[model samples]
Target: MKLLKTAAVFICLTATGCSSLNHEPSSSSPSTRSAASSEKSWWPFGGKKTAPETAAKIDEAATHAWLDAYEPRLREALKDSKFTLERRDNVLIVTAPVDSSFNPDRPGMLMPTTLGPFSRVAKLVEGDSKTGVLVLGHADTSGQAPVNRQLSQERAQAVAAIFRLSGLRRDRLLLKGVGSDMPRAANDSREGRALNRRVEIVLTPQHTLMALLAQYNTPAKAGPVLAVTQTK
Candidate 1:
């Protein structure tokens, strides 16, 4: 009877130990669970990258906001000058008369009155990482074509130099001399000639409409999406 009782107790202890071993989870299982959780967080099934068009939209919106913020102030500052500031196709066009901004005969000299306007322009466009300046010089039909072109280019270069001195990036300045080629007015009369002999400063965003999309794009978060199950 004593040997049988001892055998029964031994069997009961062995059965209980095996039951606990089967029910308790393995230590490696938690690590596997952790890895799965990490994977789900990083790449959920519903996760999607930001589309190129979306990025472009953000770029457009940001560009517009910056322009709208500065346009009114610019218009107010340049209200009385021969310079006219207008927005066209998402660019700021500053039309300044050559007579007002520079010497009549001196291609490299800027007029005394031009300092004030130049300061205002520099203040508005300088230090903007997203902005670039295109300086175009025009001439009246009074001079030889090649001579006018050279003179116009020199004048444009002169203005661009001032912009460079005003803390603008040298790479952002584009200089061109369209000498009597792109006249806002016909060069027949005195008034028309004055208009034709002018410098046009075009301020454009550094990024193109499509390129901006990527620059300003944001990706969606990879979170789980909830779905309800229908039951009969």
Candidate 2:
């Protein structure tokens, strides 16, 4: 049974029988950071993008104003979807599905950024909102730790590429490959391992966004009182 679970996680191939989707990673996002040299390629899904200068140059308070308005609207875009949102404190946990097909290496592994979620992310940046950091993580359990780590990070890059299509400044997003250092579930079990393979999107602090909101909320100071004129 566990073996079947293992096979199931290999949806890219085993998917002949099962549907073209796997719902894992809702458990815990896997994030791993490692350094390795690899050839760089242009994003296939959509062309690279950059945020407007106005969006880029702003304080946290002002950005937050944009965020305050953008967040709710963004939520609406993601409503009733597979991507789950778990917000704690100021961080937003986006457990969005990625299309494993978009992965770079094809023969051995199947990693693609799920299209649905990617589209949603693009919408956020396309709008007139504050810019911030976007960290991408790929979670997988196929190859050994070292290889899987690289794969996970590559998978993350794939998602970031899709976001780049939306036209946000590449600088606003810090693209890295976190090979599966972080696991949401146990790797011992097939189901656990599948759950481990995922992309964890954390909305790290975007001081620009915050500052924008502050200025937006700060009310204008009252003007000084005028001197009374004598009518008599």
Candidate 3:
């Protein structure tokens, strides 16, 4: 799946036009696009009121710019793993497999060790304050509700740990572990299952977009700042 996400990233789309690999043409829709992105996204989750300051980043150029900013730190954080970088329709996408070399245990919940990094688009679903929740894409209702919820929560926790490791405050990023009750893809096929196995990260408006926006604009003047930069 990580390999697929990398292949389908923005740049790959531009070069090869492999559109079917992702959710749908709608996944590239306007509403889900980042509010601060330069181009207009077809983000299915976006509102019509997306103004100049709150525009969707639908174009590949804008998404690339966004990823350009985080690549340095992200690369370093996962430097040892094979990383696939993709830019498609203005979305900076990355796919990296979990390195058993780094940590051998399977997450309490099974999902992508490295979720494709369109996570940049995860903005405050509501007014900021750092608190947010996302459903596990893979969870389904066929299983027991309690087990599903736990599974969901585990996926959330794993992603939350990742966010914390990435410097997101524990208080700021929240997760609710909604299980298979909600699914982004069909329950059939290996491809569908792979697509569904994901963790979504979201931010709230209680916090301002300034920090992310700032990072997006700067594009990290060098390589791998996450590991190399002194953590104060």
Per-residue alpha-carbon lDDT of model 3 for 100-185, expressed as tens digits?
21123543422333333433322212222323322222245546656655454444454444343334433343334344533545
- Model 3 alpha-carbon miss at residue 51, Å: 21
Off by over 4 Å in 2: 1-70, 98-113, 140-142, 208-232
Q: Highest TM-score, which number?
A: 1
RMSD of 3: 16.7
- CA lDDT of each prediction against the hidden true structure: 0.54, 0.43, 0.35
Ranking by lDDT: 1, 2, 3
TM-score of 2: 0.53
Q: Across residues 1-232, which tens digit of lDDT does each residue of candidate 2 receive?
A: 6545433344333223111221222332332222221222112123432222332343446434544655676577667666666543334446654433433335223333345555576657645334454444455556765666555555555455545556656445544334444456667887776666666554534544322222211224111101101000
**How do the predictions measure up, each by TM-score?**
0.60, 0.53, 0.36
lDDT of 1 by residue, 71-94 (tens): 887787687777888776466678
Regions of candidate 3 where Cα sits further than 4 Å from its true position: 1-67, 71-142, 162-167, 181-184, 200-232
Q: Residue 119 in model 3: shift from native, Å?
A: 16
